[model samples]
Target: MDPRARPFRSVLYIPGSKERALEKAKTLPVDAIIFDLEDAVAVEEKPAARSLLTETLKAGGYGPRFKIVRVNGLDTEWGRKDVQAMAFAGADAVLLPKVEKTAQLDELSEMLPGMPLWAMMETPRGILNADALAAHPRLEGFVMGTNDLAKELGCRFRPDRLAMMSSLTHCLLAARAHGVVAVDGVYNAFKDEEGLMAECEQGRDLGFDGKTLIHPAQVPTANAAFAPSEEEIDLARRQIAAFEEAEKNGQGVAVVDGRIVENLHIVTARETLAKAAAIAQLEAST
Candidate 1:
């Protein structure tokens, strides 16, 4: 499947060190799994985590859900070893934490050649250099590390995420510009369904392809938030029909729901339908 066509509605992070978590993840409804060997593992568990995750991936029960391994930064003691282990571990991509520039991606690409790479767009430097990072040919996506970004910025948490808007938008713009999948940061309150839904909606509104989840409970909310709704699907069909009719009539635009439907609108409408179809297919298969 094309990376852009695949559903990323819910991306869950599972600790690579936890065998139980890895096993349970195969049954979840999430669209992607971040088999985390970075912050989620203890210093002493890093090596074990890497080895276990490698074998687990090689075992191959993940199905069509995209599997990405979040490796520790190259500066860390475990980073190089993590990269080497996951290079041929059957992962779809390997994510680098605290990515600040293309050079970091370059080094990772050389170490793990022919694999897709993703970045943790967290630090101030990373946000400022979002465009540069997104431009890397090997980079496939960006996973926002909101917790780390908040700590680095020393900003208070807000439901509106007012302080983080500029950073989020900056990274999002870069992702869209470069055709990289952009996933929103995780919502930490696992038990708060209402809160998780709100953040998922917010992330979707901000043009995120999906939201990273900390818990399995958060998957449904994120999936529903990011997937195209019935109303949207209906409108997309209508817009396409109207635009096609207009084209047959040699008209430059058509009217749908008292709004102008042009070529650009048709482009968006087709994408909406395509995404909806992709989601349906993925759900059926998994």
Candidate 2:
């Protein structure tokens, strides 16, 4: 499957140090998993987490879901060893935290060579240089680190995320400009289903490929929010039918439900149908 066409609606982050969490992930319906070896692990657990995660990844029960391993920063004590261990650990990509520029990705690429790199767009410098980072040859995706970003900017949390709009949209623009997958940051309040759904919908509206989730319960919400709705699918089908009929009649535009449907609308409509098909295939696989 094309990486860009693959559904990434729910990307769950699991602590690398936990055996139970790692095993449970194989059974989860999430579209992707971020096996985290950074903030999720304690200082004492870092080494053990690295070794355990490496072995777990090598074991490879994770089927079609994309596997991304989030490593500690190179500035950290365990980062180098973590990279060396996971270089061939069977993950689909390596996620580096707080990537500020292409040089960081260059350094990581040297260590892992051909590995696909995902950036954590958390810090101010990182957000500002999102274009440069997304343009890196090894970059495959961008994961928003909203908690760290909020702390870095000294911004208060709001349900609507008014303070986060600029940064979120900037990263999204960069990701879209370079054709990389962009995932929204975790919602934090895992227990609030309504809040999670609302945020998921907001992220989807903002053109994020998916929302990073904190817990298993959040998976279904993210998947449902990001997938094309029944109404959208119906409209896409109608639009295509109308547009084709218009073309047969030598017309440049077709009207669907009192609205103009043109070539661009057909393109978007096709993409929606394709996404719905991709989601169905993914669901069937796992």
* Model 1 lDDT on a 0 to 1 scale: 0.94
lDDT of 1 at 275: 95
Candidate 1 Cα misplacement greater than 4 A, ranges = none
Per-residue lDDT tens digits for candidate 2, residues 1-286, read 2357899999999999999999999999999999999999999999999999999999999999999999999999898998999888999999999999899899999999888889999999999999999888889899999999999999999999999999999999999998999999999889999999999999999899999999999999999999999999999999999999999999999999999999999999999999999999999999
User: lDDT score, residue 280, model 1?
Assistant: 95
lDDT of 1 by residue, 1-286 (tens): 3467798999999999999999999999989999999999999999999999999999999888999999999998999999999988999999999999889999999998889999999999999999999989999999999999999999999999999999999999999999999999999989999988998999999999999999998998999999999999999999999999999999999999899999999999999999999999999989
Q: Point out the worst 10-residue segment of candidate 1 by lDDT.
A: 1-10
Compute each candidate's TM-score over C-alphas. 0.98, 0.98
Q: What local distance difference test score does each model get?
A: 0.94, 0.95
CA lDDT, candidate 1, residue 67: 99
> If candidate 2 were superposed on the true structure by all CA atoms, what would the RMSD be?
0.9
